[model samples]
Target: MSPMTIDSPVAGTAPATGPAPAVRLRGLTKSFGANRVVDPLDLDIAQNEFFSILGPSGCGKTTLMRMITGFETPTAGSIELDGRNVDGVATRQRDLNMLFQSYALFPHLSVYENVAFELRVRRTPKREIDDRVRAALELVRLSAFADRKPAALSGGQRQRVALARAVVGRPAVVLLDEPLGALDQKLRKEMQFELKRMQREVGITFIYVTHDQEEALTMSDRIAVMSEGRIQQIGTPTEIYDTPASRFVAGFIGSCNLIDGVADAATGRFTIPGVGEVPVDEIPDAAPGTPLTLAVRPERVRVLPDGARTEGGVHLPATLTQRVFLGDEWISHLALDSGIVLSASVPSGDAARALAATADGARVTVSWHPSDSRVIPTGELA
Candidate 1:
């Protein structure tokens, strides 16, 4: 496919920003009657950034998007784009384009016409419209299929058409609400890179919305994890995954080992019940005998022989209960003396086979580095 030149943002309307964000929401909120679909929220997305809104169903991701797209007005707060306030602007006037999950392609129009529909509505000159549409099609690598109808193309192809339509207009930001939800697993994986590369080449800010945690992690430069009509945390995937600010974030984003224990302020350590006591990072605000929860990631937990010595953290006996072969890695469900299970992933063939043992009954010890664990206060702030 040939590389294409994308039109720059509208003159002065999409001003340059450094560390500053292209979009900002301050105390933004919306409601359908008494039901608060989207509670008061604050967020800032950097220029040319790939930011995703992720959460479980009914978590206000869609409502927030509606507010951003002008489909739904905020009941309170302010929204700004390119350092200008546009909280009450209409959808068409908001300098943004949304690619719907349904593709929403007009059956009567061919791919070329469907993509050029907006340009035609704006009364753009015929020659320029053709040039832009052709370039947009190439961005998604679907130039040859421009003459085909939505019904004539595969799900992935139709999605690219929808994406092409959105980018053809060169909106300030592209809003994708589960854009890849329609494609099959393999095709969806492929489209992830295609969409990301297209975003990079276009240099348009992307505000993506999805309920799939893995999808959000894979594509987003930064993510806002929402729940109960509010954003719980916002950070890069690595920061959110490695150092989740709250229990809700730690548990929701990925698999974690939660160990309940009590923190001793005087000695600055915690003793996990049915496990062992270990010194902890100094938590200045926590009182003595305060109960806490330790969140540990699977990769951070390792298995060892009965007498194997490691750096800090609790060590307890575990019985190999089940081993799952997951192509790239092997996930083992090990039952500990506390009746709680700890899962660890190793390479599929060699690394996993190195620890081969009797399933359901083999015994071993598990340990984690002291810094690998997080001592979260039981009473977390949301």
Candidate 2:
């Protein structure tokens, strides 16, 4: 296999900044018998990009990663890396390394040996292998634990050994298959930063696969939201969260108050039965009376000063269903007369405390700006 060098990008080379994507998938498909695991997936990941493929269990996210890393063959289409085709390339031939979900470290082996395993298999020079292993260990802050058996290391340390093994290969791209799934919640959170730092230090393209939304949002430069063997949408974490393109993307990324409504392009608004006329930004393709879904992030709705509204947009008389203090914010769950229950996250400042003093089940007005709502485009999300 030809060697690919890894170097830290100079200043201004943040994630997603560069020339062509380090990896691109064109019309890729994979099937088992008649069941398609990955259905005609298309994606591009820029050089040194920390890209995540996120979805639920049956979403085929794992299958897509496998194809990219050459662990599983795609039934059709091509895998391109650095502008060259690699459809028939075996796993070892591709400049890729993987950190398995299980850590997959050789438990019986010493940490140093496990970290050096890849180099030994490839007949790397003994002196070079030692240097690489030590470097990799230091990169993961595990150099001090190098000689311990895998069994003797803590879960996080064992995880570092797996990561050390993968980066020791010095591959151009690294695939992390739910690398933090095994750690406890607090530990997993800590590892998220560690993994991102490792990627930056090594300057290799990282294609991390996970079903955890928070993990992806915290670590990725871009995310491909996958479901049912396909990618629903791909964008930066903020893009995916703030402006989800479809119903699925909106509903999937986080909590949403989805209302079934109808749209009239002439009026540029949704005509919900009980909620009444709600103005919208863009006139959707759907004609009047067409069944549509309206999405609003819970935090976008406002329960504010009495008589705050002067003009258009919907405001339903509501009652506070529940309220919870969530650190820096107070989460108020409101139940509207329109049968819509939504959460409003208000900053836990003086104003929020005053509002909290209002009686639970107290009547209030829930309002939203036109720009705050998204009319889920028909057919954009299945």
TM-score of each: 0.91, 0.91
Q: State the RMSD for candidate 1.
A: 3.8
Which regions of candidate 2 are displaced past 4 Å? 1-20, 305-307, 310-314, 378-382
What lDDT does model 2 reach? Answer: 0.81
The stretch of ten residues in a row with the least summed lDDT in candidate 1 is: 1-10
Model 1 spans with C-alpha error above 4 angstroms? 1-20, 282-284, 288-290, 378-380
lDDT of 1 by residue, 24-118 (tens): 99999888899988878888888899999988898888788878777778999998876767755566766778776455788888999989888
Model 1 residue-pair collision total: 0
lDDT of 1 at 364: 77
Question: Could you give the C-alpha RMSD of every candidate to the true structure, in order shown?
Answer: 3.8, 5.0
Q: What pairs collide in candidate 1?
A: none
Tens digit of lDDT per residue, candidate 2, span 23-99?
98999999999998888877889899999988988889778877887778899999887666776766766667776
Each prediction's Cα lDDT score? Answer: 0.80, 0.81
Error of 1 at 85 (Å): 1.1
TM-score of 2: 0.91
C-alpha-based local distance difference test score of model 1? 0.80
> Clashing residue pairs, candidate 2?
none
